[model samples]
Each structure stands twice: as C-alpha cells, then as structure tokens.
Target: MTFAGFLGLALQTIKAPRDVARLLLSARLSSEALWTAFALVVVLNTLVFSATIALMPQDGFGLLGNPVAFMVVQAAALAGAVIAIASIGRAMGGKADLAQVAVLLIWLQSLRVLAQAALMIIGIASQPLAAGLALGVSVLGIWLSMNFIDEAHELGSLFKSAGVLILALMALAVGLSLLLSLLGVVPQGMNGYV
Candidate 1:
C-alpha cells in the first residue's frame, strides 16, 4: 500500500474504536494500516511528553530523581496506558489495532505525567486525598482528549470509557508487578512483595 493509504487507514483507526477492535481481534493488518496506528500514537505521545517536559523546571524533582529514570517511568506508564485502552476495547467487544492502542495508551499516560508535573510544581501535599484528586483530574483530562475521536460522543460516555480503560490497565500493571515481586524480580524502588 502507498504511504497515503497507510495514512488513511491510520486516520480511520483513530476515528473509530469499534473498527479498531474488529481489525485487531481478526488479527488482520492491511498493508497500509498494519502499524500506522501504533506509529501515530507514539508520535502523539512523544509530542505531549516533550511539551510536558519542556514546561517543567529543569531543577525540579519528581518520583524518579534523574531525567533518564523519569523518562523510563513515563515510558512504562505509556505501556500501561496502552494495555488499559486495549483491555477496555476488548471488554467492549471491539478490536483495538496495536498502533491505535499504543497511541491511546501514550496519550492517556502522558496526561498523568503532565498532571504529576503540574502537581509537583504547585507543591501540592502528596496525601492520599490529594493524590486521588490529581488522578481524577488526570483521568478527566484523558476523557476529554478522547472526545476528539469521532466515535466518542457525550462527556458521560467518554468518562466511563476512559475510566474503565485506565482501571483495567492499572489492574494489569499491578498484577504484573505482583508476579514479578513474587519471583524476586521486582524492580528497584518498588516496595512490597507479591
């Protein structure tokens, strides 16, 4: 397929989550659409992340100390986001193209990262309530972002879909972390064993 065809398929994938589900579940990737969705998402994510990072003060500190570590954490978060979106798509009986899934995940995860940076800059108390509030806002931002998709209409439905996707992804991440902990392979700075 020509690059234009790939671009068209990618655009369609972004416009319709149900179609993404159909394609992904069928395990069929048309030449033009095969990896286009994923690439688009990653590009979108990188743009968001770059903007966030740029806005953050260079001297600022976060959960992860070094810039490299922060980037790694962000990358993991992006992966988690993809898993969450994919899980939601699966639950909704739709297929999510891997590319589209990756894009969704990256975009969603970037919101959280941006929120964290904003909270840190504001010096918000890192209490449970504060954390919960921050998370809620971040989730809302993600939901709002989803509204840009042609297939998603109504703020309520968008919130529900984004919430389910985030929760599903979080669950999967927790489960994987637990398994790793149990095997004594949990990463450094991660407390608790499975």
Candidate 2:
C-alpha cells in the first residue's frame, strides 16, 4: 500500500457515486493488490478490536473463546468480505482495475473498522446497536463524500444510495462469516482441526 494508493482511495471515496465506479473501472487493479490492501485494513482493524477486547475483559463466548483463535477467524472472515466486495464491484460492471478497486475498497472499509473500534471501546452491551449505527453513518459519510467531487450535489439521492449500500455490505459480511463458520474451515476456540 503506497501513500498514493491511500490518497487515491480517500479521494475516490470522497468523489461522486458515479465517479467512484468510474475510478474503479478505470484503474483496473489486480486481485493480489486488492486482496493485500483489504488484508492490511482488516489486520489493523482486528488489532484494535483485540486490544479493546483485552482491555474490557468480557465473559461470554468471547470470539471463539480464545484471542488468537478469534484473530484468525476474524482475519478469514475479513478476507471473505474482500472477496464478496470484489465480486460486487465486478458485478456492478467494474472493469477490473485492481489498484483503483483496492483503493476504493480500503477507503470505504476503513470507516467500518474505525466505527467498530469506537463501538468496542463503548463496551459489548452497546456494541451491536452502536455498530449498526456506525455502519449506516459511515456508509452515508462515504456516499456524501463522493458527492462532493462535483459542484451539483444531490444530497438526498446520495444518502439514500449510501443507506442501501451499507445494508447490503453488512448483510454480505454477516453471511460470509456464517458460511465460513458452518464450513468447519474456521478453527473453533484454541483448538486446531485437521
């Protein structure tokens, strides 16, 4: 992840919705680059989450009942998320600019990580609600940020689209997590299977 890649993603996310697609299609980044950037963001976000969990001392299942196992599961879950997003991007007619898609993904997903981190610090009881709110707000923020690229901004339309996008992404993430868990590919607690 070069600085340019970071800035490009940030700038693209802040561009218009139509422009976001345009930028992604134009850049045509590779799958490797896209996955790498996604992994980096997930790892960073997971670290923050792990730290929060460590500090809070929760008693429930506690992310597979082991911190290391939890991190591995989270990492796998996030990778699946990246695959899902890339598939979505492609289905949306993105022409496969790996670098650009990577940037866009990083920018869009960073907000989610930040939101989750914030929710975690707030404690588990409020975490779910806070996470949902953050998810909505972050998506809206990204959408609104995109509209700023041009002079004629349609705030209402952008907000509505953002809401839809947020919900879709959230569903996709949850679905991927559950699917992985069910497949028995993801390790349970501290025990290894194989």
Candidate 3:
C-alpha cells in the first residue's frame, strides 16, 4: 500500500474501528508483508518512546535510566496477548487466525503511537487539551482494540470479546509484574508497574 493508503487505514481504525478491522483482516498478506508491518510498528513505537523520554523533564531520571526495558517488556506482553487471544478465541469459536490477530494488534498499536505523537505535538500549543486527550487516547485505544478484535474474530458479542481482552491484559500485567519483581526490577512495597 502507498503511504497515503496506510495513513487512511490508520485514520479508519480510529474513526471506524469495526470497518477497518474488516478490511484489514480480509486482506491476505504474504509472510513478508506481515513481518514488514510488524517491524514497522515496532520501530515506530521505539522512536516514539525515545522521543517521549527526551521531552520529559529530568529530575531524578538520568539519561541512562530510561524506560527502554519497559518498552521491551511492553512489546513482549503485546505479542503474548495476541497469541493467547487467538488460541482461546478459536476455542470460543472465533475465526481470526494468528496472523490476522497479530496484524490487527500492530495496527491498533500504531494508531496509538500516532495519537501520542499528535498529542505531544499539540501539547506545545495547549497543555490542557493535550493532557485531557492523553487520557482520552488511552481509553479510545482500548475501545478501538476491543471493537477491532471482536470484528476480526467474528466474535459473537462485544461484551465477550472485551472480557477476553481484559482478561488477557490482566494476565500480562500480573505476569510482567511477577517477572519484574523476581528480577528485582521493581522493589518490594512500591508499585509493581514500570
């Protein structure tokens, strides 16, 4: 697809998530295309993360103490979530394959990264609006993903798909927290999240 086509798809994912999910899941990409999209999403996410750290105020956070590790963990968690959802979703009679699930997740995440980049750019002009939309962005992302996943899988009900997604997220969160704690990444008595 051309650059304009990709951007149009991304906008559709935000504005009309179910429709976007239909188109995205219907297109059969070769393994090369799938991996290319995956790599693009990861690289873009990393760049956005790096820029976020660069723009944040430095108090006790030194340049060396960036959340690069957290980003790695985040990526792993997303991959794991897709696997679990696809496997369990099949058992629950959903039709989306693993490749479709992975592609949809990457597309959803790319939309989020784009929204965050826009928020950061707009923050330069209006802090309050940016701050409000920052929270909105998080909610909207989850909503979009919930709808996208449901549509892609032909999952019978929105509520059921959302429940599955939420459960997957909780599992990942707990698993990551446990793993981090075992590694002494998150010290005891403090919040478990990065």
Candidate 4:
C-alpha cells in the first residue's frame, strides 16, 4: 500500500477500531496470513521501539543493553501474550476463536508501531510535543487494545476483557523474565533491567 493508504488505515484503526476489525475479519484471512502479519508487526514494533530507546539520550525504558537480544525477548513476550490471551480469554467464556484474537491483537500492535514511529520522528523535532503526544498515544493504545480484545473475543464487558488482558500481561512478563534469566543477560534499565 502507498504511504497515504497505510497512514489512512492507521488513522481508521484509531478512529473506528471496531469497524476496522470487522473489515479485517470479513476478509476471512487465512491462518498463515495471520501468523505472517503477527510476525511482521512484532518485528516492526521491535525495530521502532529499539530505535526510540536507543535515541533517547535518557533512561527509564527498562529495556536497556543488547538491542538485538532485547528485540528477541520482546518478540517472545509478544508471542506469549498472544497465546496467553487466547487461552485465558477462552477460559473466561470468550466466544471468539484464537485466530480472531490473534488477528485483532496483531493489527492493534501494527498501529502502535506506527504511532511509535511517528512519536520518534516528532520527538526529533520537538521534545515537548513528543512527550505530550507520547502519553496520549500510550493511553489510547491501552484503551483501544482493551476494547479490541472485548469485541474480538465476544466478551460481554470491558471489565471482563481487562481481567483477561491483565492476566495475559502477567503471564507474558513472567515468561520473559524466566527467558532472560535463562540467558543470564542483564542490562541497565530504569530500576535495574528486567
């Protein structure tokens, strides 16, 4: 897609995520395509986030040292999140299948990467503007992801979906921590790397 088309798609995701999800699901994307999209989104996010952290000139990201390794860990955490959310959501009586959950989560992640890229570019121009926009983007991302999980999983309420999301995030964190420990790799973070 052209850059404008891609930007339009990203804007649509922020403006009307439910409709975006509906259109994405209506396409009946195949399992392979879903996986491909998920991987691409993960890689793109890792690249953007790593670049942002590297360029920060300041600490607090909690993802310090070994950018390559950090990216790998992030990818693993992301995969863990997808699996955990699918399992937990189902256990909580979510009617949606794993594919639906994966697709929506992956799509939202792609949007986040786009937002991060924009934030980084804008940060280069104006630190104050970037800082304010960064906070807004982060909040909007969390809210949108929660809503996406609820809608995609057919969960009845935001609270139910939030519960699932929290559990999934906890699971992802533990899984990543364990993986990092196994590798015996530690770097400096905001409060001493994870």
On TM-score, the candidate that comes out on top is 4
For model 2, how does the per-residue alpha-carbon lDDT over 111-166 read when each residue is reduced to its tens digit? 55765666776656676686687678766765543442111222234454344345
Worst 10 residues of 3 by lDDT: 57-66
User: What is the C-alpha local distance difference test score of each model?
Assistant: 0.50, 0.55, 0.75, 0.80
Task: Give Cα distance to truth, residue 10, candidate 1, Å.
Answer: 21
lDDT string for model 4 (53-167, tens) is: 7787666444434566766786787778778988999999887777887778787777888888989999989999999999999889878878778887888798998999999
**Per-residue lDDT of candidate 1, residues 111-138 (tens digit):** 4445555555453344556567777776
Q: TM-score, each model? A: 0.43, 0.50, 0.83, 0.85
Model 3 spans > 4 angstroms off: 58-68, 187-194
Candidate number of the best lDDT: 4
Better structure of 1 and 2 per TM-score? 2
Candidate 3 lDDT, 1-194, residue by residue in tens: 77798798887777888888878777877779877877677667777766765775434433224556655665676777788778777777788888989888878777877887888788768879989999998888779878977887788688878876887788778777776666556453456464
Error of 4 at 89 (Å): 0.9
Candidate scoring better on TM-score of 3 and 4:
4
Better of 3 and 4 by lDDT: 4
